[model samples]
Target: MEDLRIKHVSLELSENQESHRTQGFSSAKLLVVRRGAPFRVSLQLQGRAFNPQTDGLVVRVLLGKLYVTMPVTFSQSGSPSSWRAYISPEGLDPQRLSVFLQAPASAPVGAFRLLLYVLTQSSRRGYKAGRFVLLCNPWCPEDSVFIPFEDQRQEYVQSDSGLLYMGTAMNIVSRPWSFDQYEPEVLEACLSLLQVSPPHMKNSRRDYLQRSNPVYISRVVSAMINSEDDRGVLKGRWSGDFQQGMHPSTWSGSGDILVQWARSGFSPVKYGQCWVFAAVMCTVMRVLGIPCRVVTNFNSAHDTNGNLVIEEFYSETGKKLHHSTDSIWNFHVWVECWMSRADLGAGMEGWQVLDPTPQERSKGVFCCGPAPVRAIRDRRIDLPFDVPFVFAEVNAAVQTVIVRQGQALSFSTDSQRVGVLICTKAVGFPRPQNLTADYKHNKSPNSTLRSRCSSVSEDVSPRTDASHGVSVSLTLDKAPVAGEPVLFAVTVTNTEAVAKVMKEHLDAQAKEYDSSPFDSFWEAHSLIKLAPLEVKALHHQIDPALCEGVAGECLVNLAVVLEDVRTQERVLAFEEFNITSPQLSIQIAGGDSLTPHTKHAAAISFFNPFSVPVSGELTITGAGLIQGKVKYSMSALRPGGRVQQQITFRPNMLGAKMLQASLALSNNTIIRGFKMVSVNDA
Candidate 1:
């Protein structure tokens, strides 16, 4: 072939002339195709034209070391589109060639490179070509073009990982967060989870198929990552009791969980809540080439019965009955897998909800789903695999009953409170996508279901006559910070022409922000008689000592109740505040300059400001900076004690690296310190 040379190359869709590539071999062009779909590539040659029968021209597709070759075909019929014309001897244009390729139904999803070669009865030399990406057809068997681009990015790409914030007031307090899944440990952890096989499954073809199937893989991963099943890897615990006194965030990423599990011989990995389980499952799904994303539902209901109602019994004093059969978490995290559900028939495919939190039983196991999000959105209660259970998580009506001793005092139903904010990582960006409205149906005004209900109503207490009026207002001292006292003031005014007597009650309670009623951290009541148009103010202080036992984040409720002695009418004023723990600062005492394979010393200092002794362990970890974990045992430091600890580590590689040190306090507080290091060969 006299050393075949090429000048330019371009790739366009088989049906259109719109080029996917303009100019360059530096970056490979992409061809998105589904299995059993026709994929064609056009190649233009500017140098020479060779006979197809004598001097064979062929195209090769390569994935890793595996390659498939197809012969270049020619016909008198010109190119299909207006932009592409046939190479003729009379014209001064480039020679044209076309190659058609087919991806079998069993082909894996990944990137494939294309190459062109010419043969003259003996040696085959390189011509010109590029690469294309073959993705699993998410819309196959049925059209699903409505799936948002954000869902596609979150579901398919491993590099774009997600984070689900825990706690009830997450939406109000915690800002949107994302995770780093490109870490080497995270990738390794994902591979390890896939390698784990079910107990009953032998190494048969069905097992192999199950390993590759996203539906089956997601279900297995949901169970295996948690120790609820024998095939599980980590023990699930909601209580904050951890072996190393580590907060859930101290473990870093999903890779940390996987590595710790394997290091413990596949035993439960310390402690994991719902968010950890969902995040780990996302890593596994993305690593195995399945589209997956982590989702967070605030005020998630755990309805015991099939009825879409979460009932709660609260005392007249606003204390929730703990023995209720049904419960609602402040927030719950789970994963959604995108795949075609041939098992459930049409309209059941797309995103399937999979909960790994070991909440309920499904098919004789503790794993939650593969339940279609579409089914939940459509309110299909009759579907199989815990569809009703998931429906209640989002669409359940919450019936709140206020009881005095044993009798019900007041009752109200709220439908919109169950799922306040349903969120996932936004597509193409590292932010939250609120899909709350997607799971909720628009109800007519005449519909029996009420989306929200007030705790107190005018019907419950007779409305005061306009002649004898009263108004109430509540205000906070400031934004509540953890380990600090929160003060609230309630003011009641008599706006009547005549003298009015009022009975005033003030209550301040610290409640779990999710669904259940919380206990009163502090309370005060005062009865006062005010003159006409007279105003009175009452104050309540929630001491830091009272909230010291409250770990992590919680909500403070300040409510004032006033009753007209003569009219028997009540006026209520309420205010809610989200109190968050103060951020702990870890001062890193070291310079940023460093060399590869050199030892570095850094000192971490923290001060104990509380009266009680504090004890915990400090963990230092980094990707390319340190080889493994560096730990320091922190003994009980007395009140007002300042402790400084020195640690040494050796850098394994070189670059701009981040070293993180997390102090997991015994009181369930996580303090973090970060330092950026620049490594040089010198």
Candidate 2:
């Protein structure tokens, strides 16, 4: 009898999932393949031919203490949710053999160990079959997270760079983000993210078993993205002050945040808002092979008390008062992950909204959703996983009222305001692709919400007063640029035939971009007389001095209220606008083409648009182009002066990639720019 020994084992990662849908992560030194799909393994033996009749072979897959052992089957049948394997029919040499291993479509994702046991008549021998990572498989029809389109899978799961739509819907600002899934420490950070989850730390067995379901995994990830639940990845702050930690707006990529979190002993990264949380979650989800996209809902509603309605109130001077717990963000961001919702039935499968912003709690945890978008569109709030809360985010009616010392003078229910222009980065393009139609049923996009306010205590419905014949409107002459005076006009019209004398009050306030307005920085009052059916436009300007001293991204809330001298009736109108920060112009050399492993010249320039001297740090980062980040600190730039710096550009990968530069000013203001270039194989 000869002692059979194994000499070499190879997991053919390149032939299986490497070129399937994503980047070069599949072709790592260790095997990283998607579950529900079969991966090939070749075993080279030094001894005799394997006898399938009398001898036995068992393959075991393990994660921590939980593992499954499945024998190599000769027959072609088994359950899709069960582990199975077989000897390849091709290349059946006596000593060398090829084997195919398949895990259940719903396999727990993460690093896994494989062991092969050979059983003889008298004894058994086991061999370590090498290590590999298992991710969710969207290409496999049997996978619960299976997405149908190849283009979608490429954009959602493979593309490391993306655009997060921010600002108002009408004036959209697409923020560039590097998901950086393939970065050195990013994948490890993702795995670490799961390992540090509450469930995994509590009961490892139950957590490993539940990871197979995307529903459960998404919920856990959602809770873990924010620090309120456990020692999550990010600490949320809606306040404008970021002196204690990094400002949310300054972070342009997820790798820096994730790596810092992982290196800091799983401490939550400070100062993340909705978009930051959503973008980071998108990175984690895509790394785990879950198709995901960052979605923006402009005029997004955050309903408190869960009544399916957001209440707001305005003062006689059109000042939005903080009277209610409910609020409507100028824009809200969340991730829509693609997966099959087996728990909710058939048609519910598709893009499910998973918010990691930690605004509302589900089942006592600060996890917003994995709520089916279909269920939300149908207004089926009776479903599980905070469907009602999501339903209100998109379809909730906004009831705004004007209060004059606690009395509701007027109110309007603008159903079309909430969830206006839901969108994400377009597939294979850099522009925005509107997904608003998917969230709203038979709703017109042109409809506008005219009223604004906080919450009033009185129970009131929208009512039109016949005696109130004055129409008021506020408009910005142009988009307010940083360091410049804000110019705007207020138009007042007497809709009735009779002449009227009115007292006009205009208030301007600086606020955090993600939350409600605070105190007014500037206010003006005047008496106006309007002739019958005549309209008058009053021009106004807000000096730059008023908007200074505010930290982080700021939006100006300009509101006007008119009081009729004849009947004491008031008409209100307001406009919310953000100052467009000056961009750090990033110019790559040679126009469009860059050769891999070669040095090229690039330039980052910024013209100080501020009246005061500016001092800050500039950071340049590219995923595959360079290692971490190239940063520089500026001494100071006088007003209206231009500063240009040269950067040595080098790319290490072939394909299209983005080079981004961001300038974080001493005032906590951040401005960024990016340029896409193609890398030639030469």
Q: Candidate 1, residues 1-682: lDDT per residue as tens digits?
A: 3434455566564442122111111112234344334455565554456555566666777654556665554432422211111223333223555555555444543446778776766666785466665433443432121234544643454343333454442323332222334444454445445455463244534544344255666677787878776646567664445665344555655657776676666667767777777877776665544667778887789988868788866554434566568887767788888777777888897788999888888887788788888888888878876788898998888776656558765555666667766766555443456666566665221211111111111111111112238776776665555567777666767887678777766666666544444666666665678888887777777777776655455555556566677775655555545555533344444577887787778777777755588899988776666656788889998877878878777876444455666677888666655555666798
**Residues 161-186, model 2: lDDT tens digits:** 98887766545665789998888778
Instruction: Please list the C-alpha lDDT of all candidates, in the order they appear.
Output: 0.60, 0.81
Clashing pairs in 2: 312-454, 313-453, 313-454
Residue 638 local lDDT, model 2: 96
Can you give the TM-score per candidate against the true fold? 0.63, 0.91
Worst 10 residues of 2 by lDDT: 451-460
Best by TM-score: 2
